[model samples]
Target: MMRFFTGLITVTLLLGGVGTVWLFLTPSGTNLRYLMADTLITTQHRSWAKYIIGQHAMETRVQAYQQQFNEMGEERDTHEIHPDSVPAQAPAAGTNHEAETALTEKKPLVEIEEISGHGYSGYVMTVNDPTKIRIGVPEKKGRGERVLSMAERTGAIAGVNGGGFADPNWQGNGFQPIGIVMSGGELFYDDLGKSKSTQVVGLDDNGKMVAGRYSLDELKALGVKEAVTFQPRIIVNGKGLIKDAADGWGIAPRTAMGQREDGAILFVVIDGRQPGHSIGANLYDVQQIMLEHGAVIAANLDGGSSTVLVKDGQVLNKPSTKSSEGRYLPSAFLVFEHPELAEIQNVWAGLKPGDIDPGKW
Candidate 1:
């Protein structure tokens, strides 16, 4: 009996070793291994990914991804949206007067729907009038504010997280943004100089979604009303840029914004990291969702633990953070009944990056 038990344990160990070798060292498992590493890179445990792949290999992979994203941003968006045709639900030439009046009456400007993919579930919000969307920032001076707070303070009907920021050691106070931030046709914050360019995602004065790489001067020239810095325009000119799931930047909570030809804005907020519920989505998945909803242009926003959707001052999506309130974000795209009247003050108006302390409360 002792000899039999010893043999069984040895066989089990051998099989485990073989399985590990097949998973980590074989070409067939390259995607899976890289997916694991990429997912880790989004989290605070980025260094843990080096255990799966060697340190040098991990750095190479990350750099390659950065290059690919930069190349994607180089492609210019040549599409334009007509905001005048957005709410064209008017009655035809020959219709009853009462019915026509009813048709002319305003519909709900914002519509929220539940959306689910392979291993993720979240919400897709459709704002009929794109011009009403504005970027909301914290009113306080020292720290960032939550999406719910931003929406409530600005009297916005709905809101979602926006842009990347300087989050050092993943414990940042979310006070500092990474690149340029323009709100209400004013340059609110800019880390890049006048000549240096960065990838931007926002809407212009005509309600046209402006994305891809642009300098501060170019953004101002284009009349960008609400702008923030983020990555890789996934869908441009009515085509998906991400080829497949492998290049989809390894599934995590994703918040992306898009626009249809008719000038309706689409916001996709996906939940992730919850095992039994939602595991998250990659860029390809987000692109597919936007395309299916008739998006001609789309770009990713600040996601992961920061991804949250708020409507009427209520949290709508499941945030992956320890607190259900979601992370305090530097900026959020908010929808208002009259966005032009929404008073969004520039919290970082006179302050430079060195003036703000991300660790301070």
Candidate 2:
């Protein structure tokens, strides 16, 4: 009888040890129902063991779950975002050549300009499929095609008005744009007669660089693209080209940008040609800093004394010439306040509220 009692006690103790381990491994939920109702848990010692084991099991369960998840493939843990899809937050404008290249792949709503319908006589084309464009300067052929600095060309005379400033024998004041082309992931057309002169022939179909500017070869090495000269300027948008030079030069190498805010795109032309007290543009000028404006891309054209803004049949700004005779420009970008354009229906459009048209004075 004593031996039978000893065997029963041993069996009970063995069952209790195994029960504790099982409770430690198992979580309390619907899955644990059978284990909870098991006769073993009804005992005081068994119930106490469950509580102690459950505390320790919680930590193990978490670690096990983490380990299982980590065992999956790396592909399940990663995602990719395209640079083009997001508006780049850049420290400075035009600095991210690679990101800029990504943007160039997408067609812009507005392009720089196009050089079509250009007869030696000069004709008009549409900007962004809207707005009329007219070129009256450069005479449209041969050397006349290139832009000359106003002060550099004493022989520059105004073809529109036959004044001393209009003398063709002398190069005149005011900037003349050569050809407008898009390059470097940007939409602006370039002008040869501007403060800086550059020609960029970029990445071609051959998968190699073709031409470049600034010696950086940015256009060639990257996906920079271009277009022809159309109405790239504001008043110059649909105006005629007039060949003439102003006797004076106001500033040099200045730069500006057209910023879009609310519903208006304002042309922020900065004067950096020379010191505020002195004349002529230099580096570090507010507008000349170039990178601060974030101009995805930009081009500098003729400026200085010849920089004239004509509106309402009158000159709006001070003409740099010592004489009020606005330098005879071979080409003039004029803004018209009255007539509207046919392309966008009304045509005369500008940043300001007044309807505007581009013309040659």
Query: What's the lDDT for all of these models?
Result: 0.90, 0.28
Clash count per candidate: 0, 63
Candidate 1 per-residue lDDT, tens place, 169-191, comes to 89888889889788999988888
Best by lDDT: 1
lDDT of 2 by residue, 101-143 (tens): 6655543322322111111111111111111111223332112
At residue 307, give the lDDT of candidate 1.
95
Q: Flag regions of model 1 displaced more than 4 Å.
A: 1-8, 84-105
* Top TM-score prediction, candidate number: 1
lDDT of 1: 0.90
